[model samples]
Every structure is written in structure tokens, then in C-alpha cells.
Target: MLPVVNNLTLKNYSHLANSDEVSFDVVIPSLPGFGFSSPTPKNWTIDDTARVFNTLMQEVLGYDTYAVHGSDWGAFIGWSLYNSYPKSVRATHMALFPELPLQPEQLEAENITLSKEDAFSEQLWVDNSVGGSAYAVQQRTKPNTIGLALYDNPVGQLAWIAEKYISWSDPRRGTGPSVLNDHEILRVVSLYYLTQSFISAAYIYNQNPSSFAIPLSKAKTDAPFLFSNFKYDTFFIPEQIIRPLTNLVYYKSWDFGGHFCGLDNPPALVQGLREIKKYWHY
Candidate 1:
């Protein structure tokens, strides 16, 4: 779910603003059925959540327009919000671009040689697809099975989530152990166990299995689009491939950090957001 919880609160934005006169009204909602929002309704997909979020901004918060940013499932929901309400969502920034890998036919059609960075990124994707996606496959296809197995078993839940926290982080953060300490891992695992949300959280994969599929017609948005790809993230979408999927306002690549950039490199994440803010017209 959410990144290191402390990193997302409004206080973090104060540091992000620095000397700028920028002020933010941050609204971080728990995804339906995760954390405090339990009992995720049947058929609640990313699109459904996106609609609800839009309503929250427009109606509840009384903001006519707002910018959106996300990573992981939040990235999917952010795109859905932009796509569904382009006028309301003024700009969009994401740390992860969720497009699926290009098909062989598509790659052949381009016939462009990959840069060294692109090549390495591609190899990483291939490796993860082959070896590291078993958990994802299970979540997508049989969430209930694993959910039931882990629901009451705190140790099992801890092991399952902690593995990702270890493996998905930048290896440089550790010499012999993971950057995430046992306490941090236990905090998240405890939240899941206490809330009884571990089961429903996995259902997100089942609800949006085709989330990575890029729209055939380009899925262009009027909102200014930006993304930052940190080196150790699970996948990378090259600039050439990403351009058609977004409005393509800004793009940056970081040599450090990983999937959980908010935790692994909070200042860098904040800096990227600040950069995106420069292009925010609304």
C-alpha cells in the first residue's frame, strides 16, 4: 500500500516547499479495503476508486481542481483519475509508469537500438517477470487463497510483506541486511493484521490485472505529465515508449533509490514533486 506512512503527511510538503510560498492541502485517503477502509466492496476496481477520489476532491474538499501524483497502485488510480476527469485533475506526476512491456511486433516496428540504460532496464524487467512475479501472479489470480492463508497468521503476513520490503529496495541501502529495519517492517505488518485488511489488500491485483496495458489510441491527457524513474524500481519505461502514453511534459531518471522511494529517498521524491510543480498551470 502506502509508502512509509510518515513520508506522506502534510508536514513533508513543508520541507518540499523550502523558500517557496507554496502551500499544499494534502489529502491522503486509504484505498478502499486497505488499512482503516475495510470491507472493500465487490468489483471495486481502480476506476471506481478514482471516481470516488474525484468526488472527494470536488465535493468534500471543495477544490475545483487539483494535481495528482502516485506510485504503484496509486499510479494506476492517478492515471484513471486524469483520464476520467482531465479538467478536474490539473496535472499528473508519477514515479512509476504502468505500461506493459512492448510486444515483439511493436518493438520490431520501432527497430531502434536500445541505449545502455534501456537495455539494462529491459533485462531487469525480463528477470522479474520470470523469477519475481510469482507473488503478483498469485495475487492477481488467487488472492483469496493466499489471503485466507495469511489472514490470521501474523508471522506469515509479516514474511509475505517483509520480503518485498527487502527485495524491492535498493541493494545499496544494505551491506548485509535490508535498509528497512525490523521495526518498520513490523509496523506495516501489524497494521495489516490489526485492521484485518491483508486479505482485501491483495484483491487489488485481482481487480486490475490489465492495469499495465497502454491504451491503443495513446490515452493522451490535457494535464501536464511528468515521471521520475528511480534506478532500482521494478520496471522502467523508456522516454521513447512513454511519450505517446502521456502528454510528456517532464521526465527524469535517478541513479539511486528503488520502488519505495518515499522511504528510501524521501528528499529526492520531494524534489521531483517540486520540479513537476513548475509545470503545473492550474
Candidate 2:
């Protein structure tokens, strides 16, 4: 399945794009293979997507400098843009910055003391690693196998993706209306199946195995970076932990959003993105 996390960003957060206060033009790519965008070559990595995206901005669109934002695997691709072409990419904002969560054993090995909320996030990481990531494993190893299986079976595809939307999001369904309701989930699945991009979307995992195991050493950057941490999100490594390793200029947290920050809390997402303008020269 595709990173529904990115799908949420594509569908929601119109406040940033539509706001009169935000003066910049918004260009959101369908990201290689999520919906209408064609799937990349089997060997293509996230960096390839970044390279083409940069070309689209600087050459095709005739923009000298720009800012970027993303979540989920989109964050990985966004990181590639900032790391490889920081001069062109003036600033970076991410709902989910590319921070690899320490495994339970590694956490114990480090013997780090964290705040209660941060510790809870670390525990969530441990739990998700064991149970919430089987789909990722299957997709990473056998995209085609499952892709073919679900290509024509729209119901199967919908079910496969809906589970992720339900679980990864913040836990607040019974109390009130969910930010992403049934209609939203159905919308994403329908788009995937209708475009026949269901199979190709899964290839992102198989093609970019490096995303899941990204080394902290690669987090270094000279360009301004903003991270919006949603406390209820799947895996959150605290700012204090990540600040020393990178050029993390801004870090904010909220209890509202989850993996789908754009959908869960668009205002917060918009605010974080706008905050990057302070550092961006253009």
C-alpha cells in the first residue's frame, strides 16, 4: 500500500495552500506512485524522485529557490531534496522528519531517560515495530505479489489500506468526529484502484529499503529544517534527542495530530510550514 500519510497531506491542509496570508505558490507532486503519478522503475530510490522533483522546480517551473514539506515516505524524499540540493531547496518542513526510532533493545542499551510523554512515544515505537509493521515488511519484499493480488480486487485493496488509516491515526473516534472519516479513506483507496496505481504504490517500500533504516548520521544539514511533532503520531523522537544531530531550527509539538497531521490538524501543519518562511531567504 502507499503511504497513506502522504495521501492525507495531498488531500488535506488546504489552509496553507489557499490562505491569503501564505504568499508562496504551492506545487504538490503526486509523488511518483501514490495515485495518478506513474510508478517509478523498480530500481528507483527516493533520491531519484527528489532529483526529478528538483528539476521540475528549478528548470521546468523556472523557480530559483523554494521550500518543501512532506510526511511519511514523502519526508524521506523531501530529506533527499534538502540533503542533495540544499542551495535550491531553501528550507524544509516536515510533519514526520526522517528520524529512525531506536529499537527497544537499543533504547535499553543507551539507558536514556526521557520525559513521560517521550517515553510513551518510545514505547509506541517498540509496539509498532513488532506488530504494526508487518504490512511494511510484505510490501518491501513482495510488492508485485500483493500488487497483482489486489490489482483487480478493489475491495481487497480498500481493506488493505483502510486498516492503516484507522490504526495509524490518533485515537479519537468514539468521542467525536474523526478528522479522517470513512469518506476520506474510501476516497484514497478509490483513487488508487481507479488509477491502477495500487501495485506501483507499494513498490516505494521495496525500492527504498533505506528509508526504514536511515542512519542518524545522515540527519546533518546546513539548510533550515522544521519538524512538527504530533505527540499521538506513531513514532516520535523528541526534539532534544534530534537537535544535536542536525540543523533543526524549529521544533513544535501538539497532542492533537497523528500520522496524518494535515488531516488531523491542518492549522497546526499550516503554522509549522509557515514558520519555515522566517529562515527561507526567498
Off by over 4 Å in 2: 1-21, 108-111, 173-178, 218-220
Task: Rate residue 94 of model 1 by lDDT.
Answer: 88
The regions of model 1 sitting more than 4 angstroms off are: 1-18, 103-109, 174-179, 213-216
What digit string (tens of lDDT, one per residue) describes model 2 on residues 210-256? Answer: 68675656553577888998766887776766676668889988777
lDDT tens readout by residue for model 1, 16-118: 5775525456678888879998666887889899999999999999999898889888988988887779888988878887667664356659875666766
Per-prediction tally of clashes:
0, 0
Global lDDT of model 1: 0.77
In model 1, the Cα lDDT at residue 112 comes to 51
Error of 2 at 224 (Å): 1.0
Which window of 10 residues has the lowest lDDT sum in candidate 1? 1-10
Model 2's alpha-carbon lDDT is 0.78
TM-score of every candidate relative to the true structure: 0.87, 0.87
